[model samples]
Target: MSSIPSPTLSAPSPRVNEGMSQGTPACPSSCDHFDLDYTRQEDVRTVVETMMTAHQTYHNRMHAYFKKFPSKEAALLKPHPDTTKEQWKELCDLFTSEAFMKQSEQNKKNRSKLTVNHAAGSRSFQCTRACMKNQESSNINPVELYKKNYTNKDGIWTSEGAREIYRQCDLEGKTYTEIEVYSEILGKKSGYVRGLGRAVKPPPSSTLTTQSSDLQHQLAKARDEIEAMRVAREKDLQEFAKKQAEMEATLRDHREEQWVEQERIRLEQEERMKMEQEHMRVEHDERMQKEQEHMRKEQERLPVEISKKLEKKMSSVMEKKMNDMSKRLFSQFGGSKK
Candidate 1:
């Protein structure tokens, strides 16, 4: 099986912290419940983006880990080491379910049809705005912020559509906010805010009625939806925290295992080297003994070889002397007879 590519997860941006500080409910020691002011657009945007990013990050991580196993049944049978059996089973069911698979395939198709993609990565438009304000110490023009987030660093537009939208916004003048420009040019989308990502849902549509009762009913419905979103956001945050802790623990365990494996290899190499050295030493000793034995045999045979040569020389010298003495005696006897 092909290895699963792990998704890169980042810490919550500064905008998330800013949003939490401004809009998150603060519960006292004795109080269990607190209220969120959904009317504030900035706070609402912050919460929405945080929740959406966290949810997407979590879904991607789960899918990446699930891909490690050959099948959903196998994955459920052997849950991730970092997750509980119950959690793993639930994830397996969700990933393998027909409804989810259909949605996932549809999402892929939708992504493939896109002509333009922002270069901002995980940074939301709100975070981009915050950064602009901090760096320039001035309020960023909404159109300029949109351009910055959509275009590349060299100021090239990602797509002709994005560029045309910018041109339209420019011709319309500077009064329009980023969201207003998108809504005006692209037409208002029913479910989500036009410029913001899919996180922030728009207010429900209301009938053009003069009656006070109808207005009250619309307001009540809006409040219900807002409350529901707040509750869902809280739950998402809790799940994200739990998963983050598990990932960290898993990383630590992996590092420890890697270190242990490296140490084992080092020790094995040392043992092999010691054995090689011992073998070389034994060979050296055997070679020295062979040389020494050869020299001792040569030394013992040297005296016998020298004694044989001396005996042969002395016998030849004695025979020559006896021949010379006989010749002299014969010559003298012959002279006396004459």
Candidate 2:
């Protein structure tokens, strides 16, 4: 087999044929010396552009991915384009309502979180009447999806799951008015929003966002100081209560001592009176016996006839003799002879 002939290496003609400048290099031009990072710079620009595009894409759901609805009725009636379009839009709205309702419920749930089981977890949900009305997110049909997935008795949402729900939905770093705070606290079982602020911090296009953030931080610190003061006051109140209890105990002890002293004095007086009464009684008995002896002696000296004549019978006279007995001798001596 014969090898093919090699092509001839011929140089181009050196003569200038065109009307352009003669000194310029043909292939290797002035751009060759310019300091450039062509590939790396292009790669960086491409990466930044791609990230920004992705962020924008996620910002709003794409119409190409999610079909558009001309109107509310159209969204409801013609959700599936395969269906007929002859009927009145409002009346036709009843056709694919289930799909609308399912999507609506799913989107709301996607925005909000819920809990299951007997944990009785708090889920903060749309507590504001205005915000909830603004959302316009509910089932087209009267289907109980929230009730099914989560536990619900009436139309009202439970505080148990509303906490985390409110947390995700709450705006960052903004403080609510007292009324809004009360509604959020009392109405829903507080979850995430409870710990979070009410409104967005550093909102878009704010010129004074930095100042506002500083103010918010300062306000929070002030609130913490006030809370600390309240706690100190509470501690002081507790200490006062302890002191009051101690004082009451001291007063009780003093009162008990007073009662004991009074009782001792009373018992001493009673014993003295009892002794005097007993001595008086003994003296009275002795005096009565002496009188009886005197009477008996007189009767013995008179004789039986005279004694019988004095009071009818001798023994009866002796039995009932003395009258108007002496005064109490107990008072004469305070347990000592007068």
State the lDDT at 78 in candidate 2.
Answer: 44
Which ten residues in a row are the worst by lDDT in model 2?
Answer: 195-204
What TM-score should be assigned to candidate 2?
Answer: 0.31
The true-versus-predicted C-alpha distance at residue 85 of model 1, in Å, is: 4.0
Off by over 4 Å in 1: 1-35, 38-57, 67-82, 177-182, 185-338
**Cα-based TM-score, every candidate:** 0.40, 0.31
lDDT of each: 0.67, 0.45
Worst 10 residues of 1 by lDDT: 26-35
Quote the positional error of residue 177 for candidate 2 in Å: 29
What C-alpha lDDT does candidate 1 achieve relative to the native structure? Answer: 0.67
Give the per-residue lDDT digits (tens) of candidate 2, residues 48-95.
644675665542332222346556544554433433344334323432
Cα lDDT over the full model 2: 0.45
